[model samples]
Target: MLSVRAYVPADEARWDAVVAQSRNGTFLHRRAYMDYHSHRYVDASLMVEDDGEPVAVLPANREGDSVASHAGLTYGGLVASRGLRAEATLEAFERIGEHYRGEGIRRFVYKPVPHVFHAAAAEEDLYALHRLGASLVRRDLSSVLSPRERPAMNTMRRRAIARARAAGVAMRVGTDMAPFHALLASVLERHGAVPTHSTAELTLLRSHFPGQIVLHEAHRGDELLAGVVVYDFGHTVHTQYLAASAAGRACGALSLLLAELVGGVYAQRPHFSFGISTEDEGRVLNPGLVAQKESFGARAVVHDRYEWVL
Candidate 1:
């Protein structure tokens, strides 16, 4: 028999065990990440079990009438063990649907696990997602470079990096909160946005995932130019959050920071995820941002966001 339940504190060990066994799993699937993010977002994690064995897990966050599976998570979806058939996946989704309805959520957003992370899945299990009333939404393209192919800088990229380097820009990596937070805030203001993570959240993530979370800062002597927070998830490196100051822009600091990150930290990982861009072969939203990533030789590997109205 199968059962679906809310995540409990006691399920930590088993939960992590399941995540560890799945290629699609990420740190967001870990208890600590869910707990920390959940505390801020409130009651967002869900799990499914069959005969007392965990079959699937969905990390989600609730805001008003909407319940998003792993809202803050860049890549997310159901975490199932190998050999889970379509019937089982569909059943799990049904249970999840019921749970969302009971919880008064009007919409359920599901983030699909990337293909690279689901090498062992059966076709039927993969198709079950669409079979469950999940419609496609957005997609993100990822770029990767093997260790040997990693180069310092290409033509166009080199020009941008050179401009910054020639201007005497320096890069720093650390976990300090004050300067990092301030620099990020400045970037957000320039972009007419707000910082997503609070100071406390940044501290928690850094403290928990020490080597995994990196704060890269570009500076011209004492002046902070640009900074980005990269997340190193075992096999993939993600440019999670990034920002640049006005002065930094004058010297092309943002480009330099990315060049260093790709050649430096990400060179070690098998795949480096530059995150998503709205630009496709046809014009789409956020074309400029997409073009910027492409100039770095990033290839689009399309993935979808699924949604169901409860």
Candidate 2:
């Protein structure tokens, strides 16, 4: 029999240990990351144990009579070690469904990690979600580049990088998040919005996952021209935020930064994600944004979201 226990602060050590061994789990799923924003969500996270051994964990929170696989993070679902077989996944999800139903939770939103980010096989939960009749509710396309098979940068982008390098625009790992967040906010504000994570939140996360989350910026002496905040997920590194100033665009500083990142610093990683270029629950495509990412030789991979009536 499988049983679930509500997660609490004391469970951090145990929970993180499981996540560390989870095939599909990224640093985002760690207790340190989830608990950092605990005040924002009604924590209903769970630890699933079968025959007295932890089999899986869910970084979830309550929403009405429904439970979400963590709305606070980009992706979330059952996190389990590669040791679990498909049959075990199905049984485990059945237990999870039953537990939620018993607690009057009406539905569950499952966001499985995309295959591109996986360091090992981790799609068993997808099969179980199908068995539970989960419906696909959203799918965002992320642009990605594989360093070893990297396509030649188009002539324009190549020239931009060459020109910037020729003029001495430099890209380097950075410690400051304030200026970059302001740059990010300014960029998004032009389109009528703000950064998803405030500067404070970003600083807090960096403190928790120091090595996992890093900042890279393009500069000319004291001026901050462009920057990107990257999340390192072992085999793949994702660009969480990308922004450039008008000055940056004129001098092609951002193009230089990304070129160095995708071809230099992160060149050996299996994938370099350019993040999503979709909005409106993934129903609308931003052609211009997609083209910008594609200009760097990136291709698309679907990051899907699913829903179920518990």
Candidate 3:
């Protein structure tokens, strides 16, 4: 028989061991980061045990009547071991609903895992969510470039990349966080959205990940035009955040920045991820933005989100 309970402090080492062994694991799935970030919200981490051995873990945050899987996490869902099959995953989720309901949580929002990670789970999880009246909100698509293979981009985008390179825009990558944060703030202001992280969070990530947190900057002489902050996870490089100045748009700086990043990844990691974009049928869903990334030979892979209300 299996039992579910709140995460205990002593479970840290064992919990991390499980995450490290799982192919679907990500930094956000680790207990340390989750514990650090969950302080800002409610911590609702659940650990499943089979005869006292930890089998699954799901970290979440509770706010009023709603609960979310790891509030600041980019991707989230249940993390289970082989012993905890599909039926067990569903049973764990059902227990989660009960706990949340008792805690006055009426709605639950779970971040979706990419197909790559989702393939390991028991198929019953999908059915359980639907049977429990969960609703699907949005689906995103991730694009990747494999260093072993040519980038996957359309001809027009390829030409744009060539044109940008021919223009002689210079690209540089570093670990400096100050300039990157400044550029990021400026870009956010242009879009009328406030930054989600403070300088401290950026610093924390840089300190924790070291070479994994890379900053790519595009410049012309003394002027900084665009920059991107990426996370290098050994096998793949993830574009965590990016921003561009007005001068960047005029001088093809964004294109140059991407070219450098892609080249850098090609020289090292097996693949690079361009994150995802919002879906919009009318105008290509940030067409200019998508085009710039697509030019670097990225191909879209659909990502979906799942939710449940208890």
Q: Which one wins on lDDT?
A: 2
lDDT of each: 0.73, 0.88, 0.70
Q: Better model by lDDT, 1 or 2?
A: 2
Local accuracy of candidate 1 as per-residue lDDT tens digits, 1-310: 5678888778888888888776567776788777776656766677788888896777778899898777777656787766466687788878888888898888988777676444354344347667776677666555444433674344876787899999999898855866878878876787687777877888897898788788888888888788888877767677777777777777889999888877775667666666666555223656677667767766666656777888
Q: RMSD of candidate 1 to the true fold?
A: 3.6
Candidate 1 vs candidate 3, TM-score winner: 3
Tens digits of per-residue lDDT for model 2, 1-310: 6777787788888888888888888999888788777888898888888776777789998879978887998888889877878998898888888888888999898888889888789899999999889999999988988976766788889988987888789988889799999999999999999887888989999999899899999999889999999999989999999999998998899999999888888888889899899999999999999988999999999989999987
lDDT of 1: 0.73
Error of 3 at 137 (Å): 2.9
Against the true structure, what is each candidate's TM-score?
Answer: 0.83, 0.97, 0.83
Candidate 1 contains a number of clashing pairs equal to: 0
Give stretches of model 1 more than 4 Å off: 39-44, 62-66, 83-87, 98-107, 116-126, 138-154, 279-284
